[model samples]
Target: MRHFWCILLAIAILPGFCQALDIKGVHYLSLQEVAGKLGMKTRWIQQDKTMQLESAWTKISFEVNKRDMTLNGTRIFMGYPIVASRGRFYLSESDYDHNIKPILTPQLSGAPPGLRHIVLDPGHGGKDPGAENKSIGLKEKALTLDLANRVKSKLQARGFRVTVTRGNDTFVSLENRAQNANRLNADLFISLHFNASSTTSVSGVETYAFTPNLQPSTSRSSLHSSDRKTYPGNARDEWNTLAAYYVQRSLFTSLKARDRGLKRARFTVLRDIRMPGILVEGGFVTNNTEGRNIGSASYRDKLATAIVDGILVYKKTLDRLAK
Candidate 1:
């Protein structure tokens, strides 16, 4: 039954009209290889004691009290323990997001200290079934995860460190979600979310970033200014000012979806994060045509590819600016 569903999800990513992505040479590490590469040994400590391993110049440990885990003495709350699979300790993708990646990659860089750690948050999970596309019988949570996973795969292939908020159909709170990003000091926080309208007439793709340090009224006024300037409109008018300018732009080219234009708004997830953050409203699930497309494996794959392209573009812009 699960395999049947997996196949369906895989099919949905192939958006028929879009060009296929070049996804070659993506290497994922096994738990033991990940541990061994760092010169750490995995031990099954049955006592109330902690299990610690040293790797990549970082010391990692699992706490006996609760699921609390840490690396380099920094605390990370894991909802699940690292499991041993095939004689090696394997960390679930979701667990890696909350526990391992936080300590491994804390900065965003283009081949500097290392590849940037990205947090791909699939908004609305478990009981909170975000928007529903009745036409296709697709739940927003399912679509979000499907796209997030695909994005993760493509990015991994392209040599970027990626993390996902929810790996399965489980509930995760906003606070915890933000905390994961905060703890990791993520280079970027990209939240995957689909739109829904009661009228079913609305459809388009929009990206959002939190208002700058300025007050809401002031920001709103600036957004409405005759200059026609938009969000992240800095005094210097820097490139990609909307926080996701390049990403949103690249996405439009890849997905060929409606361009709703980037905007500024107060969202709980984006506001508190320190790094550059953007929330992607892919399309409206309420609209019949879009709902079905969102439910398809091919389209979801394109969506994921579009997102990965955006991130790569953002990285290139950052590198140029840094130089």
Candidate 2:
């Protein structure tokens, strides 16, 4: 383990790493400098307080003081909001390491993981019905199970080994869910779920990976002492970011739904997982329209297709990197 960290430290100080500025003790990198290092040309939209970096294969847009950014048109939330000082915008080094570097320059982040076996976890079952919309008769547990089965079928058809945390409406502890995957020696883990909100109008799809050490999750604006803690799942932080990004992008594009953006969270299942994993909030079960949509078999099939597509894309990315 000490040797592993030593190698990571060596990589962090490489030329590709940003020149960091100490801002309230957090390290940050100038947006312009980041763009230059990535071989992207920067353009500022002063009126909108947005800066865009474009290159032959990538386009990223960052807004001053915002945690959400667009990478090649996919919405993703940074660990910290962009900081502005002396007419310049800066991104947290944590964001660069966990989000940007993994997506744009994955090879430098680390070696790509094998993509052969996958474990699909349906979020809740049995007594844990999870989120529900009684008005529309939609239950998150049932929807997740259906979606997981659909995804499993599609994945198996594409020649990948797949396992499910549960085959029916049976309760499985969160820790057991992850441990099952580890025991199976799965290459990837995906937990499927539906969302709900007190506000009925709130609706969208979002994906979550384990939060990087010392970085706040998407829902939090400030870091907490607990943010410094690392877990077994953090071992695959780079791959988690990459997988979540692709899955979120594919879902938004195929479903034509609101892009909630790829997010970070320390969910129990994610924190205990031994391999790259993400928990997907497919949509809101409480939203009137979306709730009805989740009840439909065709929409569920589409969601499965989009998810399978994303996994294929991620696999292709790793394959390309290996060569």
Candidate 3:
């Protein structure tokens, strides 16, 4: 009988239903607000299987489940589990779209939110010749700048605001790189470089985060225990951990590159920056074959996409963890 009455009530309300009002912010409406909007009274019965709402000439009873919600004794599907937050029932966007749209006229197409600003730092410039491969004549500084530009473009397309440390051929100091990030309040920092080795066979991608204990000398010669040149403490540690986990994972998954799991070391940009910073050794420029591949425009674009995807994945994980 409850189911039958709910069906009748739904039919009565169907013809006069108006489009849903715009929902602002990132929160859901309360049940009382939902009832008032729908012109129905809602009640909670002590029995787990049944609920009652009395308003106007109708009384409705429905059963609530972990994955489903029944209204007027009618079973309704839910996209995610029903959650109660702050003493109010909450449903995801899926539930609102699938279950409520038939009765509510206004519908919105879902678009993912844009990411916060990203700071791209091209490693080495001017006097700094990071690495060189004879075969393709790829210089680490030039390649890093090119790759950084490509990454900036791709990230822009994916709705991320992008800024580069050096737009052209001029060199930017390590201090300026971190300062730029601080000025922009960037969310992610990526520094691009290519690796070199005495052995020509070394090839693969490696990502580094910040480590207070692993601070190396400015010349990369020997450990400077007494240098007293260490910058601030692990200010960027949290961001680096997130960056390392997401970037390293995404790079290997998409590019099928070797996994050089997250490592910590003293990279000026990573250590001084206030945000999550990562330095990417795209591939071994010392390797004959890998240098050729890194020089290609197509491969650079793929690499950019991988980095962007990693940022997105990290963003999602952060969102989930925040809840």
Candidate 4:
């Protein structure tokens, strides 16, 4: 009977075998069923139009009609909004399989992959200056390269091998960046960049993983035909989420910056990468206050330190799971 129950539990999580409802042409699973499978308890807050799934180690909160969700206090954007039907909330099957399940049950996905070799991509070089604040004499390309070097120093000091995509201020194509990492057999890839906005008031840190197959990116409100296509990075969806979560959490907490949430995008640098990869928007260079801060060497050092701290935390998680 014990073995029978274990078999049943295993069967419950299989996408093909699990029960689902067709909602607006998409398959969805009830929050109740999700909670049961994950050994969590569900609490519905009618007043707030929110539902929470809580366990000893994790707390996941979802709001009706919103793609934003929180996991263990860190913000993450779901591919689809939660829907209410018959007083019960449902999560899209795509998000359940690609986002929620991978994050909550990382161990079940597979053994943690090798994390010693890291590839750091400093966004925009040579001719491409990326985002810039002319008034503050700040350039995104120069800052990213400096930050990459600082992070490389810290990571190397910790005994991990690190590689930078471009060692100088020379242009490197997006395709070449991913291909270089693949050729070097890098375990992890991080693309570093500073952001700009027409509204200079916008300033925060954002981390992005490759958008999962069949799921809309965080930037998109609806799924597109291209969302159905799977990329090489999709193979590491679980690891990508885990890595991006840790890095984004660290950046937000350490820098006390606005929490922009963990997002997903089908960026060329991440789409074809063969390893767990993420792109980091360190901060906005357009903001008056933030632009000046970014121009200073100390703040860039702090950014590098925070990023390395996140990498360390991620490595520790893998180490613990391996044990």
Candidate 5:
């Protein structure tokens, strides 16, 4: 019986399509059917118009004839609006699959339990210079350290106990950085770095969480992809995924930077962290314009503030869930 329902849910969750499509080419499912089928308790708040669903961990509110839905208080934009017909409200396929599914069943990135201590990792130092653009005199190692320091201060101001892997222009192995977070019992880990590419024109910010088990990474290369292995990092894949989303969203939205999309990678620093962790490539150092922006102290401050803001947003969501 469970297997049968699993197959049903699978059918309902296909990308760009919901459980069933009407003759009108609109894909949708009954609000009650979706909630009952998914084992979520549902109620109508406005006698018939507003529908609410709650699971053990998530709460979602929707309205008939409305294009917006609130998942745990976060407004989600849907491709199709809810409509009333045959005395039932039908939810759009895109909303159910993309916006609703991720929050309700966050297989990609689970929400964190709480936010307390955060470890900021500044990538590359000492003998290693990390990424650099000699044309602009910007070195990744230095920029990361600076960004980490500023982020640490901002996080501290927000009452989060913050620590950095490298506080100065010194060397710290990737292994040690992860170990340090485990040692401190940090709740979150964020590694900071600026990117470099041969193509100087390309520039943007992308964040990475550890590759989930059995899933190919976003940048999976036939040459470098490895057999699926569950590391300590994969244990917190949920938190890692959510944290990466927060970081990427916060940075790009506040700084008006390019969106490079969230990614999955198996960097040693992220692979071994016991807590939810992510690495952020802030921007392209090889780009003439962006490289200059990254080199600016004020710009680094903005980036740092945005990172902190993102963590706060992530924390706020978890805090609401706990309540």
Candidate 6:
């Protein structure tokens, strides 16, 4: 069987400690193998069908039959459920490659990436109001701009050159947004938006990076079109993924909202970015409870603060990688 050959190939090629298992023609690695790579301590809780991986600063918990795991209390999707084999738990090869590696070991590139200049995009402007919550009269455009102003101020305090694509209630096309950032020679690009769902109950923070080449987006509906192209944005896919995670975690801490997990999309703003880029949908505007929060000045300030906190973590990681 092809699967059997894959298992043989993995064992023959990988270091002895890996203990790789092939499942359905793909390889998965054992908890011990992953723990060794990440320098984390692993505890197997057989009764609860859980494995806890802890490091000096964080603890991550994974459970069988679940596609999602908790990273230091912030929920992150694994892209596929981890399975148990002969009392050892395994992480899917795709999940480890597309999800875990980027978040934990981001700077795989020989040269380190920096975040010296940041471009903040306030999604939808003059002509395009984007999603809106009619009950509270909150338009997505105004909210994003307000949040961008605060974020710009925050980033400036952190010693980064910060600029927004739109300074007022003006329209800026997606291509223009990317071009503006490129023109500025930005080191990072962050596009901000407020989400809306048809279902009123849906509310959470979602962060997105351009889908990697030969990979599908997190949402199934996007698969067909996403298969069409890859871009320069893929150059620093690892950095983009880690940056998204840092901000997603910080947003959870500041907003106390649901962690929707880091996602992949073929967003125009991201696809053409020569530098690392991410888009943040802070929360759903359609949800009445969250709509009010998104409309508040205090909440906008917190959003800015969360972004700054995330960027700080990302910069620190870059510094460590450079050394």
Note the Cα lDDT for every prediction shown: 0.61, 0.90, 0.63, 0.89, 0.77, 0.83
- lDDT measured at residue 44 in model 3 versus the true structure, 0 to 100: 74
Q: Deviation in angstroms for 124 in model 4? A: 0.3
Each model's TM-score? 0.58, 0.93, 0.59, 0.91, 0.70, 0.87
Candidate 6 per-residue lDDT over residues 112-142, each given as its tens digit:
7877899999999999999999989999999
Ranking of all candidate structures by their TM-score, best first: 2, 4, 6, 5, 3, 1
Q: In candidate 1, what residue range of length 10 has the lowest lDDT sum?
A: 17-26
The candidate that achieves the highest TM-score relative to the unseen native structure:
2
Q: Which stretches of candidate 4 lie over 4 Å from their true place?
A: 1-20, 46-48
- Model 2 score (lDDT): 0.90
Candidate 3 lDDT by residue in tens digits, 44-88: 775444445556654434344354454332333333444443234
> lDDT tens digits, residues 176-199, model 1?
887788788777778899999898
Candidate 2 vs candidate 4: the TM-score winner is 2
Summing lDDT over every window of 10 consecutive residues in candidate 3, give the lowest-scoring window: 105-114
| Ranking, lDDT, top scorer first | 2, 4, 6, 5, 3, 1
Task: Score candidate 1 by lDDT.
Answer: 0.61
Tens-place lDDT per residue, model 2, 185-296, is 8999999999999999999999998999999988898888889898999999999999999999999999999999999998999998889999999999999999888899
* lDDT comparison, 2 vs 3, better candidate: 2
